[model samples]
Target: MKQSQPRYIMVGGFLGAGKTTAILKLAEHLKRQGRAVGLITNDQGTGLVDTAMARASDFPVEEISGGCFCCRFNSLVDATRKLTATTRPDVLIAEPVGSCTDLMATVTLPMKQLYGENYRIAPLSVLVDPIRAMRVLGLGGGRQFAPKVTYIYRKQLEEANLLVVNKCELLDATQTAKLVAALKQNFPKADVFAVSARTGDGLAAWFDRILTGELSATDIMDVDYITYGVGEAMLGWLNATARLSGSPVDGNELLLRIGCALRDRLAKADAEIAHLKMTLTATGDGLDIAVANLVRTDAVPELSFRLAEPFTEGELTVNLRAQAEPALLERIVREVAGECGAALGSLASFKPGQPNPTHRVDAGGVEHRPVLP
Candidate 1:
């Protein structure tokens, strides 16, 4: 028996934009209303902190690893097929690679033109951290990404059907107004919204739109592939899974220690941090997550979540993105694992190469092969 085509709600943004947190909020909202939800997480590598975080929330997750959706379109569809075979969720919430843009041409178009019979593509939403918005919009001063990297980030905003200013709590009414005005002035076409996914400040309206609003064709932003590749190469990407055992250490504390150590290492390298997030899930009843982010070179690392207790054994997933050399990032990861008493497992650390879209078809019948860098 064939079930009805489910809805695909994609949430996109640049690094440190809080896309995962917003997706979790939307999932929880949908679940509360008796709607079955399935999640899809994409990354350049495996052992994704986002994947682990979704599973920690107890949602069924399908991870499209090794590449972004544009490069792994077939795998994304296959994951959806597998989820349909099992969970058959009414809504499929997906988070694409933060560094990716042009989804209207790549991901959603393929989903609609080919799988129109199986999936309803929702409006394209792009999230932005308030602090990031200020820096990107030139409304405030802070250490920022290089010119090429900022180009990719700007393209992400330029292509948004809905531009969501996440982490609104950090901004007061006046500051929020200023940022909103700046975003509107820049991307006048996109409908701007402000919300705090953590505090539930203004998510209902966004959720309602995603649930019932219509989705139409979007403008494909002009992107220079060479520049995009350069921007991506400027950032070192690291993903790893480690085993933690012996004398139960506070999962939160251990993660904090590891993150602090890594932050110090990156700082010494004179690297500008983008985002460093980790999640630890013990074999017992729950999971703990610790995320430290340094948006710029001269910024302090801020922990988003801290563990409450200790755990004996579990799996830990760590993901780091920064403007630095991949070799240095890889070395710091190894040293951090050793110094923090973690038994390392499968690990991947490298700079993201140019995203070569394997499929750019509007209608169905296109087979996409994963392009590994």
Candidate 2:
């Protein structure tokens, strides 16, 4: 007789999709059901917003940094094994990099084909931000992506076993219905659901499905190897940590200003902000400091920090994304911190930092060595 293994559920999405929030809600739900949960976060670089958010939950969070789970498949397995060893969780939820796709072939298919004896792969649920969906599908006028970026976005949806329309609360019923209809017509085989992680709407049904669902491998997309490779190569990732000294500024206000400032700056530079997120965890006080992500400058920010208490000192983690150069991202962080310090009537200390690039794949299907700064 063999020991029962933990169920593995992976939630994936394009840039700015609400995968992190959905995972948090799902973890909470599972915990309420008396199940211990373990979380794994993947990112293209070392400093990841998702990792910080997941860790803040105080759960057993493991991070597979510098690569998506597919490119780092062995690391994914190792992380799962470590999580299993420590927590023996009933369920394990993993969130992959936002810009990544082709999970069915690279991740799910391999997992089922190789690790079926030790774990069960839940349906691969890919989340779509309504705004991004509209932009990618040409339903609304927004920043147009280069051909390669567009290719990755579409490929992400192409491999999903479940397509979830996220941030639906921002749209009216009619608008939501229109999007859902279009998604259904386009991806007829996958089950599509509308969920607002912010409001907990339609999550219960989604949860129910996850609990009883079986993930059969789907037909993965044939990606343009070269184009796919270049698109990913052009993108640079940066995550940083900063020590702040402020006079007990309102955490929410500070986060709002910082997020808006960064969004505005990135927009002026004509750089696409795939996701710019920051999390502030205070040291002494019990209050949740602040967390905000700007998927788009024009869109409303998402908050990961809910105030349960207040604190005077803390560490702040900044996760930035842009189509600009990696150096540009570092500069942007410095400028944002200066502005935030001035607003708070004090100065915040930011140390020199570099994004540790974990994965670099080209369209030719060539893998590059990880770049560390």
Highest TM-score, which number?
1
CA RMSD (A), model 2: 5.4
lDDT, residue 9, candidate 1? 90
**Which parts of model 1 are misplaced by more than 4 Å?**
1-3, 284-308, 361-373
Displacement of residue 56 (Cα, Å) in model 1 is 1.3
State TM-scores per candidate: 0.91, 0.87
Clash pairs of candidate 2? 66-358, 225-363, 226-363, 229-362, 229-363, 287-309, 287-310
The models' CA-based lDDT, in order, is 0.82, 0.75
Error of 1 at 68 (Å): 0.4
Give me the displacement of residue 264 in model 2, in angstroms. Answer: 1.6
TM-score of candidate 1 to 2 decimals: 0.91
| Candidate 1 residue lDDT tens string, 1-373 | 3237688899999887888988988999888888889999998988787887788788999999888998788999999998888898999999999988767678887788778788888888999988877988898887788999899899889988899999999989999999999999999989999999889988998888887776776545566778878888898898888888889666666666777788888888888788888777776745555544555545555666666666788877778889988888889999989987888998888887677886664333354433333
What are the per-residue Cα lDDT tens digits for candidate 2 across 266-342?
77878788778877777764235578888865665667675454435677777776566777776777788776553
Question: Cα lDDT of model 2 overall?
Answer: 0.75
- Overall local distance difference test of candidate 1: 0.82
